[model samples]
Target: MGVSIVDVAAQANVSTATVSRALRGLPRVSESTRAKVLATAQSLGYVASPSASGLASGRTRTVGVLVPFLDRWYFGHVIEGMDQVLRDNGYNLLLFSLGGYRHGKMRRFTESMVRKQIDALVVLTLGLSAEELRQLHRTDIPLLSVGGPVEGCSGVYIDDGAAATAAVEHLIALGHRRIGYLRAGIQDEKNFEVPALRTIAFETALAKAGLELRPAWCMVGDFTVAEGQRAAARIFDAPGEQPTAIFSGSDEMALGLIFEAQRRGIRIPAQLSVVGIDDHEFSASAGLTTVGQKPLEHGKTAAGMLLAELGGTPHSLRETLMPFELMVRDTTAPPPR
Candidate 1:
C-alpha cells in the first residue's frame, strides 16, 4: 500500500487533522507545523488525494477554465498564466473548450458543470446569456472573467474601445484623412462585445477628428490573415478613392493586409500605411504598428482574483481594466503629399 496521510501525521508528531490543515495551507496551522508536515509527507512519498481532501473540506482543489478557443494566441497565453498560478497553489485545472457544435453547447456545458465539483470557474471572452449566467450563479462558486466583462462577476480585461481609438488616433495624427477600418465580422452567437466596442470607438474617434467615415472604408473581415487579405482585395477593388491608411482590428489581419499589399506592388507606409491591435508576436518582427495589450498579465490577474475569493479573502466584484500601449513601428508615417 502507498504511504498515506496517517503516516505523514505520525512522522510529523501531529494529528491527522493538523496534517490535513497544513497540507492544504489553511491559516490555523502554524508555520512550523506546516513546514514539518510538508517535509514529513515528502520524505514518506505521501501524496494527498484530491477526492479525500474534497470530502474533508468542501473544496475540490480544482479550477474550471472555460474558453472559446484554446488554439487562438490570446486565449492560449491567458491560460498559460492561469495554469502557472493554479499549479503553484497545488491546484489542478479543468479546461472546457466551448468552440464546436451548432447549438446547445453553452447550455449543455453550463448545466452539466453544476454537477462537477470545481472550486472556481474562469471564463475567457465567451459571453454568457442571462439564463446561462443565472445557472452559473446557482453553482455558488468563485467566478472570474478575462478578455471581456461579465455582468455581476469580477473580470480583468483591456478597454477595447480605448485601445482601438488609440490606434485610430495614431493614424489621424500622421495626417491620414481617408483611413479605412477593418474589423472582425460577427460569425457566431457568442457575444463578440470586444469587436463591437472597438468598432464604435473607431467611428467615434473619426467623428471627433471631424473626418467623415466613408461607407466604403468600413470593411468586415474575420480576425485572421486570410480574411485580412480578402478584405484588402475588396477595399482596393472598389471604384471609390482608396484609403491612404488602414486600421485593422488585429495584428494577424494587419500582417495579412501588408503581405497582400506588398504582393500587389504597393509600398507600405509610403502608399498604404497600416495599423493593428494585439501586438502579436509577429507584429514586432514584421514592423507592424499596433496597440499592445498583455494577454498573459490579464490571465494572471483574473486567476489571482478567483484564488483570493476562493481563499475567503475580501475582494471586489468589479471589472479590472488592463493597460495598453501604442507601438509605432515602420508601418505608419505621414500621409503622402
Candidate 2:
C-alpha cells in the first residue's frame, strides 16, 4: 500500500489538514512545522496524488502555458525553464500553442481555459487583446507573461527598446554609416508589439546618430532563419545603394544573413557587418554579435511568480525586466575601406 497523507500526518504528529497545507505551500503553517512535515513525508515516501491533493487543497497542481509558436527558439527554451520549475515543485504543465494563427485559437483557448483546469497561467510573448484579456481574467487564475508587456498582465522580459538601441549603437560606434535593418514583421502590431518597439528603437538610434534609414536595404525577416536569408537576398540583389552593415532583429535572422553572405562570398565585417538581438544557442559558434538575453530565465521567473501566487503568496504584477548585455563577437567591425 502507498504511503498516504493520513500516515504522513500521523507520523508527523499533525493533523491531515496541516500536512496538506504544508505540502501545498499554503500560508499559516509555520516554517519549522512545514519543514518537519516535508521531511516526515519524504521519509515515509509519501507522494500526494494530484487528484486527492486537488480535492483536499482546492488546487489542480497544474500550470497552463500559452505560446504563439512552439517551434520558435525563444518559446521553447522559456517553456523548458517553466517546466523545470513546475515539475520540481510537484506541478504538471499544460501547453496551449496557437501555431501562429491566434485569431480563432486565442478565443477558443480562452473559453476552454476557464474550466479551472490549471491553477495558474504563463503566457509567452503573445499580445492579448482587451476582450481576450477579459476572457482570461474570468478564469480568476494567477497570470504572468514572458517576452513583452501585455495589458493587465505582469510581464518578465528584457526591454526591447534598450536591446535594439544597443544593437544599433554598437554598429554606429563601429563607424558603419551605411547600415540597413532586417526587421521582424508581425502582421498584428495591436496584439504583439515587441517587434514594433524594436523597430522604433532601431530607427530612433539611427536617426539620433544622424544616419538615414535606407529603404532599399531595409527588409522584413519575420524573425526566422529562412525568412532572414530571403530578406538578405532581397537586400543584396536589389538595385541602388547597398548597406555596409545590417542590424537584424533576431539572432536567427542574423544567422541567415551570415549564411547567405558567405554563400555569396561576402567577407564578414570586411565587405558586410551584421549585428542582432537574442544570443541564440548558435550565436557563439556562428560568431554572431548581438544583444543577449536569456529566454530561459524569463520563463523560470514568470513561472515562479505564478507558482508563488498559486501557493497563496502573490508577487508584484508589474513588468519585471530581465537582464541583457551586448555580446561583441566576430561579426561586426568598421565599414570596409
Candidate 3:
C-alpha cells in the first residue's frame, strides 16, 4: 500500500482519529496537532476520501437551493450571485426545481433524493404556505427566502411594492395624469405574484395623489413581447381618454411597449411616457426609465444566511430588505400640451 491515514498517523506520532480530524479540519482539534498531521500527510502523499469523511462527520458541506422558475432573468441573476458566494465559502450547491403540481413539489422535497444531503435550504421567490413550511421545518434544515417575505423563514427580499410606487410616482411627477398600468398574468396564485402588488401600489399612489383609477387604464396579461404589442394596440385603438403615461411591471414588457408605440408614430416622453421595474441589462441602451433592485445581491445574501445557519452561528430570522434605486433614462418625461 502507498500511504494511508494509518501511515500519516504513524509518521506524525498521533492517533489515527487525530489524523482524521485534522485532515477534515473539524472543530475540537488543536491547531498545533492539526498542523503536524497535515505536514505528515503531505509528506506521505495520503489523501482523505471525501465520501468517507462526510459519512463519518454527518456533514455534506452543501446547500439546497429551490427556485420557482429558472428561465426568468431575475432568478438567473440571483443564481449567479448565490453560486459565487457559496463557492467562496467552500460549500457546494444542490439545486431543486419545484415544478407544476403541489403534490409533486412535496414529493420531490420529502423523498429520499435530498435526504441528509444538504446542510441548509434557500427558496427563491417561492412563498411557502404554513403547511409546506411546516413540512420543510421537519427536515430541521435552516431555510431562507428571496424576492418576497415569508412568515417564519429567515429571508432576503426587496420592497417590490415600494419600487412600483416609486416608478409610478416618477411618471406622476412628470405631469402625466392619464396613467395606464400593465401587469403580468397570475400563474402561481398561491406562491407570489408581483404584478398584484404593483397594481395595488399603482392604485394607492394614484388615489393618494387624488387621481382617478380608471377601469379602462388597468390591463393584466402575460409579460411576453407579443402581449406588450397587443396591450398597446388595445390602449390606442380608441381615441377617447388616452393615457399620457404607462407603467409596465417588467423591463421586457416595457421594451415591447416602446417598440409598439414607435411603430404607431408616437414620440416617447413627448407624446407618451413609460416607466418600468427591473433595470434589465438593455434598459440603459434602450433609454428605458426603471426601478433598480439587485437580484444578484439577493442571491448572495440568501446564500450567506444559509451558510451562517449551517455553521451554527444562528442569525436573525427577520426579513432583510435589500435597497432599490431609480434609473431615469430617456423614456419618461412631461407630456405635451
lDDT of 2 by residue, 262-282 (tens): 999999989999999999999
- Count backbone clashes in candidate 1: 0
lDDT of 3 by residue, 7-65 (tens): 88889998875675566544446779878887877777776664635323446778787
Candidate with more favorable, higher TM-score: 2 or 3: 2
Cα error of candidate 1 at position 177, Å = 0.4
Report model 1's TM-score to 2 decimal places.
0.82
Candidate 3, residue 226: Cα displacement in angstroms equals 3.7
What are the TM-scores, per candidate, against the unseen true structure?
0.82, 0.82, 0.78
Every model's Cα RMSD, please? 7.9, 7.9, 8.1
Please give the CA lDDT of all the candidate structures: 0.80, 0.83, 0.76
For candidate 2, report its TM-score: 0.82
| Order by lDDT, highest first | 2, 1, 3
- Model 2 misplaced regions, further than 4 Å: 1-55, 102-108, 188-190
User: Which parts of model 3 have CA positions greater than 4 angstroms off?
Assistant: 1-52, 100-113, 188-190
Highest TM-score: which candidate?
2
TM-score (C-alpha) between model 3 and the true structure: 0.78
Judge candidate 2 against the unseen true structure and give its global Cα lDDT, from 0 to 1. Answer: 0.83
Using TM-score, rank the candidates from best to worst.
2, 1, 3
